[model samples]
Target: MVDRLGPRYASTLGWLFATMVSMLFVYRPPLSLLMLFLWKVVGLLPRAVPPVVIARKYRDARASVLSAFNAALTLISLAGPTIIGIVASTDPALPSILRATTLLIPIVII
Candidate 1:
């Protein structure tokens, strides 16, 4: 969905999400389960690259692109537990803001 939206709009959405999330820390607003789930959904959005977009983007080298993508996903899967463990170890009481920040890292990079 985000890839289909293209880079500009995708960036807009990311900024909007960041702004809303930062407000939680700034204002200390009451958090809801739905909002937390939405944050996760947003964080996961960048990982969902549509096949059509991938096909179009790498028309000349689809196989190579796909292989690289697959490798990256594998690396991420392998590293995720390590990354989470390190982050979680830093503070036993990992706050929601920190959790959300960790989740949003990929989206921000995208």
Candidate 2:
């Protein structure tokens, strides 16, 4: 897939796929289960593509780019749930937390 699509497009597609799937979590229907199932099938691309994209995109600054990427991932893993939890408490709605989480998605996408 990466060979045909290229790292940039493949990674973008992965992120877009993730965004669409994550939004479905708010729905909580029989369809949501289908979406979750689809995600489990395709989620590997995003995890595998990003490092290749970062490596190619920042060829000269690979070390710093990786460091920054790792740092951001660390921050997201720690902070994402916390932000979602706080918003979920005040509003008790999925959309509210989705909105908050969407703010961070762009950071990773860029």
Best prediction by TM-score = 2
lDDT of 1 at 19: 48
The positional error of residue 89 in candidate 2, measured at the CA in angstroms, is 25
Where does model 2 exceed 4 Å of error? Answer: 29-110
Task: Predict model 1's lDDT versus the native.
Answer: 0.49
Mark the regions of model 1 whose C-alpha exceeds 4 Å error after superposition.
Answer: 29-110
lDDT of 2 by residue, 16-42 (tens): 465555444433222335444544444
Supply the global lDDT for candidate 2: 0.48
lDDT measured at residue 5 in model 2 versus the true structure, 0 to 100? 83
Instruction: State each candidate's clash count.
Output: 0, 0
Across 1-110, the per-residue lDDT of candidate 1 in tens digits comes to 56698655564455445545543443343334654454444444344798676555545354454456556555545444444433433442445555566556544433
- Among these predictions, the greatest lDDT belongs to 1
